[model samples]
Target: MWRDEAATWQVAQRSTAEIWHLLANVDVVHGLYYLLMHVLFTCFGPGTTTLRLPSVLATAVAAACVAVIGRRVAGSWAGLAAGLAFGLLPAVQFHLQEGRSYALVAAGAAISTLFLTTVLQRPARTRHWAAYSTTVLLTGLLHWLSLMILAAHLATLLWTRAGRAVLARWAAAAGCAVAGVLPLIVFSRGQSVQVAWIPPLTWHMLIGPAVLLAIGGTCALPDRPRAGRLSAATVGLPLLAVPQLGLIALSLLQPVFLDRYVLYSMLGLALLIGAAVGAAVRAARPRFPTASRWILPVTLAVAMSALLPQSLATRSPASRVDDVLAIASDIRHLKRPGNAVLFVPPLRRDVKSLTPDAFAGLRDIALAVPPEKSGTLRGVETAPDRIRAALLAEQRVLLVTDASPGARPARGARDRMKTAVLHRYFVPVADEQTRGRRVIVYERRSTPR
Candidate 1:
C-alpha cells in the first residue's frame, strides 16, 4: 500500500524536470499522475493525509459517475444504489486511502465510459465524440493500462449493434487514445522489469473475477424488460468480463493479472447489482407493496454487513503486506544514532525515503550519492569494496532486508558481501520481522572469527 504510494510521493518530491526524467526511464505509465501529484505537493506541502486526499476525492467522483451511468441506463433508484455500492466496494475503499493513481484512474475510466455512452446515444453529436476522445486521451495518460477498458466498450458497442457512424467514431476515439499513449507504452515497456514481481496466473488469481461473476450472474437472473436501450447486461457484463478475461489470457504469455489494474470494473458489477435490486423492488411493488419498500434497504444492509469486516480491516496497516510507516517506526525505535544501515537487495531505498524523519538519525553506509543528487530512487550505492570497508569501519550495523527465513541468499556481489561481512565479523544482537520486511542488528565482536 504505502510502499508503492511512498515511491510515488518520492517521485513527486523531485523537481519537475527530474520527475519527467524519472518517468521517461522508470514509471512512464504514471507520468501524468506524478505531474498532478507534483503540483498538489507544491501547493499543499507534503503529508500522509495530503498525499491521499486526492485519491479520496477521485473515488467520490468515481462514485458519482457510476450513479450517472446507472441513471442513464436504468433509473434513479438504480443510480443511487449503484453509487452506494461503488462507495462500499472494498477495493474502492482501499484505494481511496492510498496515495497512488489507481483511484484517479478508476474515476477517469468511469467518466470516459460515461462520455462514451453519451456518444453512442447521440451519434451525431460531434461535441460528445470530442469529449469522449479527450477523456479517453486523458485517462490513457493517467494510466496506459486503463485503455484496456476500451476493449470492453468496443464489445459493448458491437453487441448493441450501434450505427456504423457511431462505431467508426468509437474506433477513431480509441485509436486516438492508443496513439496518444504510444510513447508512454513504448517507454514503459523498456521498464518492464518494474512489474517482474507479478507471478504467473494461478487459480488464486481467478478468485476475485470468479466471485464478481457469481454476484453479477445472480443479479442478472431477475428480468428487467424495461431496463432501457443500453441494458445493464450489455454494458455491465462486458465491463466485468472482458478486461479480466483479457488480462488472464494475456498473463499466459506474460504475467500481468493484478486485480487493482482493473479495479474500476467493479463499477460495472455495482451497476448491474443495483439495477437488479431496483428492478426487483419495482416488480414487487405491485404485489406486497409494504414489503417492497424494505427490499432495497434490506439488500443494502446485508451487503454492507457482509463487507463490514473487510472494509474496516482495509483501513488498518496490517491489511497491507508491508506497512512502510510501521517498518520505519520500528527501525527508529530500535536504531541508535550513527549506526550504519544497509538495505539488502538495494531496491528498498524507498522505505527510508518514505519516512525521512524516522530514518534521519541513521546513516546509510553504502550510499555514495543522495537520491536527489543522483536522480535515482535508491540513490547510487558505493562500490562493493567501499561498502565492505564501510561495514568493517562501523561498530554497529542495522541490516534491513526484504528476505524471508527460507528465501535464497542475496545474488548481487554487493549484497552477498554485506551479508558475508556482517556474519563473519559481527554477532547478531537483535532481530525483528514484519510482513515482507526484516530488520536485524549486529554488533562488532571483540575478536573476529
Candidate 2:
C-alpha cells in the first residue's frame, strides 16, 4: 500500500467513535468513505481486497453508466465504444483500484448524467427529478469537488435550450442537492489546511486540459449537433470542458486543480469518442457494409494494445509515490527492542500506524499522544527541547524519512531541531533506502560527552 492507501487502512481500523472524533478535527470530507470502509473491514477483515473492492465495483458502474448514456444519445455501437473507452482512459485506470472516494464520486456523476439524459428525452417527471437530486446530493457528500458537475449540467441545459419547465425543474433539483451538501462544505472549510501542499497553478497545467478539449472537440465535430438537440456534442462537450475550466478558474483563488477531482469528466470524453465511432460506422456502411461491423472491436483492440503497458504500470507498486508497506518491512527487520524511533516530518508515522507490529518494542520518542486519541492523522509531538533531550539520552535511534535527497529542508522548529541534533550527535550505523523511503539506524558519536 502507498501512503494514502495506508492512511485509509489505519483510519478505517479505528473504532466508530474514534473515526467520528477524528473527523471533528480533520479529514471531514472523507468521513463517509472512512465509515463505509470501517464497516467493510469489520465484516471482511482488513486486507488489500477489502480496501479496494468498492473502487473496482464503482469504476465498473461508472463505465456502465457511460455506455447507457452513449446509447441513449448516439447508438448501441456508440454505447459499447464509450463504455470500453471509459475503462481505458489513463485517469480512470489510475483510480480504478484506489481506496479513495473519487471513483465513487465518478460513478455518481455518471448516474446523475444518465438521469438528466433520460429526463431530457422524456417529460421531466417528479420521480426522475428526485432521483437526479438524490444522486447529486450523494455524489457531493462523497466529495464536494464533484459539485462542479452541477455547473457542467447547467451548461448542458443552456446548450440544449431547454424549455422553462425543464430549466425551472433543474434549478429546483440542483438547489435541493446543493442545500443538502452545504453543511459539509461549511464544515470542511476548517480543514482547508489539508490542501496546503498543492502547488500554485502554472502555464504548464493548462496543457493537459487543452489537449483533452482538442480531442473532445475533434470528436464533437463529426456530430454536427444542433444547439437544441440532445446529442453527444450538447451534453458531452460541456461535461468535459466546464469542470476542468471551472477548476482552473477556482485555482486562481486556491490551488485545487488535481485531475482526479474531475475524473468524471472522462465520461464526457468517452461519449464523444463513441459518437465519433458511431459516425464513422454510419459513413463506412454504404461502401463496406460487411467490414463496418468490425470497426468498434478493431478500434478497441488497438486501444487496449496501446494502453496495455500503462495499465500494467498502474497496477504495480511503482505507480504510487511511495510504498508504506515496504518501509514498514525494513523497519521490522532493522529495529531492536527499546530502540528510539523518529519520523523526520512526523507524518511518516503512518508506517507505524498501518503496521504497528513492525514497530513493536520501539519507542516513539517524539509522540505526545496517539493518533486516535489526539484526533489527528499524525499524533501530536513534544516541543523541540524535549525531543532533543530525549534524543540525547537514547544510544540508538531509527529514522524513517522520505527518500528524496533534495527534499525541502525542515521548516518547523521541532523538525529542524531533530535534524540538527541527529547531525551533531549521531553517526549512521546502517542505512537502507527503497521504494521512495529511507530507514536508517543511527548511534551516538563515540567521543560524545
Candidate 3:
C-alpha cells in the first residue's frame, strides 16, 4: 500500500521550485502517480499518511459526487441511495488510503461524468465545451483508462444533433492528450508493459475479476422504472466498464497491470448499481418516502458485505515494503558480522515487484534498515543471477520472495537454491513460513561437496 507512495515521497522531498522540472525530466516511470504525489506531499508533508491522504480524501468526496450525479441522472431519492452505497463500499475505502492513483481516478471520472451530462442537457456553448474539455484533459492525466470516461462523454454527446460541435472538440482534446503523454511515451518506450512481463492474458485474468468486482459492487439494481432513468444508467455503466476489463485481460499479455490502473470505471459501476436498486424499490411502490429509505439501506448493506471480503483477501501478505523492519529484524537476530542480504532473482530496475516492497510481511523491516543496507537490490534465495552475483560477492543473504505468482512459496527455497546452483548453500540459519516467502537466514554450506 505504501511502496508506491514512498517511492513518490522520494521525489516530493525536493525543493518545490525544482518540482516541475523534476516531473518533466525525470523518468519516475510510474504512470503519472509521481506528479500527483508531488502535489499531495507538498500539502500534507512527506509522511506515509500525508502522501496517501489525497487518495483517501478523494474517494470520500467521490461518494458524494456519485450521489450528486445520480440525483441528476436518476432522481434525488436514487441519488441518496447511490451515495450511501458508494460511501460504504470497502473497495472505495481501500483505494482511498493507498498511494496509488485509483481513488482519484474514480473521483475524477465521476466529476467529469457529471459535467458531461449537465453540459449535454443544455444547448452547446463555448463555456460548456471548455468545462467538458478541461475535465476530459484532467481525466486523461489521472489514469490510463480514465480516457474511458472521455469516450463515455463522447458517446453521450453524440446522442443529439447539438453534440456535433462539442463532440468535434475532441480533436483539440486529442492534441492535448498527445502533448501531455508524449514525454511518457518517449521515456517509457523501452519500459512499456510489452517489454517487461512474461505471462499471457487469460480469461480469468481479464473478465473474471472485473465481473466479480462489478457484481460485488452493484449487483443491487432495482426492478423499478420510476427511479428516474436508473435502469438506463445501470445498463450503461456496465457497458462502459466491461471494455476496460477486456483491455486488462488483454494487458496481462504484457508485463504489468495493477488493479489500480483499472479503477476509474468503478464509480460509474457503483452509481448505476445504486440506481438499479432504487429503481426496483420505486417500481414496486411509486410512493417515495416509505419504500425509498429501505432500498438504499439494503443496497448499502449488501455492497458493504461484498466489499469486506475482497478487502481482506487481495492485500498481498508478502508485500515487503510494509514489513522491511521485520525482515531486517530476522536478519539482525540471525546475523553474524559478515552476513549479507540478497534480493533473490535480482530486482527488475524500477519494478515495484522486483523490490522489497513486494513483501508485505517484511515491509516495515525493510523500511527500518539503515539507508546504506536498507535499499540494496540484492535478490532473495532463488535469487536471480545478476542479483545473486551481487550477493555472492558478500557472505550471507536474508533472501525472500513470493515468486509463486498467486501461489505461496513452496517448502524451501533455501534448500532449492542450494541445490539449483549454489551447491555450497545451506539452510543453516533462517526462518521458513510458507515456502520461500518468509525470511531465510543462511551461512554458506559448511563445506563444498
Candidate 4:
C-alpha cells in the first residue's frame, strides 16, 4: 500500500463516531468514501484485498457502462472496442485497483452519462430524469470534482441542439444534484488546506491533457460529426475536452488539476476510438468483406499487447512513490527495544498509524495526541521546546523521514527543533534508506564529567 491507500486503511479502521469526528476537521471531501470503506473493513477485517476490491469492481462497472453507451451511440463492435479500450488506458489501469474514491467516482460518471444518453435518445420522462439526478447526487457525494461531468453533459446537449424541453429538463435534474451536494461543497472548502501541498500549475502539467485531446481529436476526425446528432463524436468530444479545459481554467485560480480528478474523461476518448474503428470497418466492408471483420479484434489485440508491459508495471509496488507497508517492515527490523521515534513533517506519522504493530515497542516522542482521539489525520505534536527536551532525555532516537529526492528540509518549528537537538547531542549509529523513506538511528553522546 502507498501513502494514500495507507490513509484509507488507517481512516477506515476508525469507529463510526471517530470517522465522523475526523471529517469535522479534515478530509470531508472523502467522508462518504471513508465511511463506505469503514463498513467494508468492519465486515471483512483489514487487508490489502479488502482495501482494494471495491475499486477493482467499480472500474469494471465503468468499463461496462462505456460499452453500453458506445453500443447506443455507435454499434456492437464499437461497444466492444470502447469497453476494451477503457480497461487498457494507463490512467484507468493505475486507479482500477487503488483504494480511493476516484475509481468509484469514474463509475458514477459513466452511469450518469449512460442515463443521459438514454433520455436524449428516447422521450425524456420523469423517471429517467430522477434516475439521472440521483446518480449525479451519489457521484458528487463520492467526490464533488466529478460534478464537473455535468458541464461535459451540458456541452453534449448544446452540441446536439436537443431542443428547449431536453435542455430545461437537464437543467432541473442537474440543479437538484448540485443542490444536494452544495453543502458538502461549501463545507469542504473550509478544509481546503488539505490541498495546500499541490504545487502551482506549470507548462509540463499541461502536456498530459494536450496529448489526450490530440488523440481524441484524431479519433473524432473520422466520424465527420454533425450537430443535432447523437453520435460518438458529439458525446465523446465534449466528455474528453470540456472537463480538461474547464480544469485548466479553474487551475489558473486554485491549482487543483490532478489527472485522477478527471479520470472519467478517458471514457470519452475510448468512445471516440471505438467510433473511429467502427467507421473504418464500415468503409472497408465492401472492399475487403472478410478482412474487415477482423479489424476491431486485431486492433484490440495489438493494443493489449502494446500495453502489457505498462499494465504489469502499474500493478507493481515500484509504480507508486513510496510503500507504507515496506517502510513499516523496515521500522520493525531497524527498531531496538525502547527506542523513541520521531517523524519529520508529522505527516510521515501515517506509517506508524497504519502499521502500529511495527511501532508497538517504540515511543512516539513528539505526539501529544493519537490521530483517532485527536480527530485529525496527523496527531497534534508537542511544542518545539518540549520536543527538544524529550530528545535530550532519550538515549536513542529514530528519525523517520522522506529519503533524498523526495525529502524537503524541516519547515515547522517542532521539526526544526528535532533536527537541531539530534545534531547537537547525538551521533549517528545506523541509517537505512529504501524506497523513498529513510530511518536514521541517533545515539546520545557521553557527557564529560
Task: Please identify model 4 stretches exceeding 4 Å from their true place.
Answer: 447-449
CA lDDT of each prediction against the hidden true structure:
0.82, 0.91, 0.53, 0.91
TM-scores of the models, in the order given: 0.93, 0.98, 0.72, 0.98
How big is the RMSD of model 1? Answer: 2.3
Clashing pairs in 2: none
Residue-level lDDT of model 3, residues 1-449, one tens digit each, is 33344445555555544454443433334436666676766777667687677787888777887788777767776678677767665556566767677787777767766666665555656666566566656656654455655555544444333335655665565466546655655665554533343455565666656674567345443433332232335334543455365457547556444555556556666666666765776675666667656776676667667777666653554433343223333444555554454433332111223243333332212122322223332213333354334444545555554334432332344334433444364444656534223455655665644
Q: List the candidate numbers ranked by TM-score, top first.
A: 2, 4, 1, 3
Model 2: which ten-residue window has the lowest total lDDT?
Answer: 402-411
Model 3, which residues run further than 4 Å from truth? 1-6, 9-31, 89-91, 159-162, 193-195, 206-239, 242-258, 285-289, 305-325, 348-397, 403-421, 425-427, 432-437
What is every candidate's alpha-carbon RMSD to the true fold? Answer: 2.3, 1.2, 6.6, 1.5
lDDT of 1 by residue, 121-140 (tens): 65468777777888878888
Q: Per-residue lDDT tens digits of candidate 2, residues 1-449? A: 88888879988999999999999998999888899999999999999999999999999999999999999998888888889999999999999898888899999999999999999999778999999999999999888989989999998998899989999999999999999999999999999998998899999999999999999999999889898888988889998999899899999999988998899999899999999998899889999998999999899999999999999999988898888878777888899999999997888899888888999999999999999899888899999999999999999999988888635677689999988888889999999888878898999997753
- For model 2, the superposed segments whose C-alpha errors exceed 4 Å read none
